[model samples]
Target: MDATPPGWPEAVRPPGAPDWERTAVAWLFDLVPPDYRAHEVLRRYPVLLARFARDHVAAGLEAARSGWRTVRVELADHLPADAMAAAMTAYEREGARLAAAARGVAVVSAALRGERWVPRL
Candidate 1:
């Protein structure tokens, strides 16, 4: 069974779909070992993931507000437990999906750009 939680279909896609940079990050993450991914996530704690997602979205909105796409940092991990857990899970699931999607998108984008996907050393 696909471990994707509810609303995954709608949430997985970034607002404008995967941009080149995000697509690249997604691709890079795919080549990373599963154990490495788990280690990184555990190191950061699930709460950090949720906070990062919130800050990222808020930064995007703030950028729009100022007619720029720059993101600013805010206090992190202060959100309530229930909401934070939900957000964290959603973010984790979406991150995994995006990584896989990015690999696919990278291939397409590379073909369009007349390049090939090159894994970083």
Candidate 2:
């Protein structure tokens, strides 16, 4: 795992747990569209976040799981592979954008909690 440098920003860590990146990614993925994300992306996020946490800011895994569950419910009827693929591509792009925004929110939340900031190396 990558170590946080001394005096890093508190926003680097997520609220309510030490595994901040997992929590943050989970939270960010929640904002994504349900149909595209539930099946195509949800399964991959945990592993991806695990790697991300090793190298970057912390995230929220529970939030991601909840988002996946909601997405699955929203898209109960599965679509053809072609349509699913297209939708998933769009969702991934949007999800990345949303993740960045969520990161900002995580940072702010950390500050509100009075946690120390740690920069990702």
Local distance difference test, each candidate: 0.40, 0.47
User: What would the per-residue lDDT of candidate 1 be over residues 1-121, giving only the tens digit for each residue?
Assistant: 2232222322233223445334434433343444545557723443333333334444443434443211122213565667655655655565555444434433433333434334355
- How do the predictions measure up, each by TM-score? 0.29, 0.29
The reply for model 2, stretches above 4 Å from the true place, is 1-84, 118-121
Lowest lDDT 10-residue stretch of candidate 2? 50-59
Task: Report the Cα lDDT for candidate 1.
Answer: 0.40
Candidate 2 per-residue lDDT over residues 90-110, each given as its tens digit: 556555654655455544344
Clashes of each: 0, 21
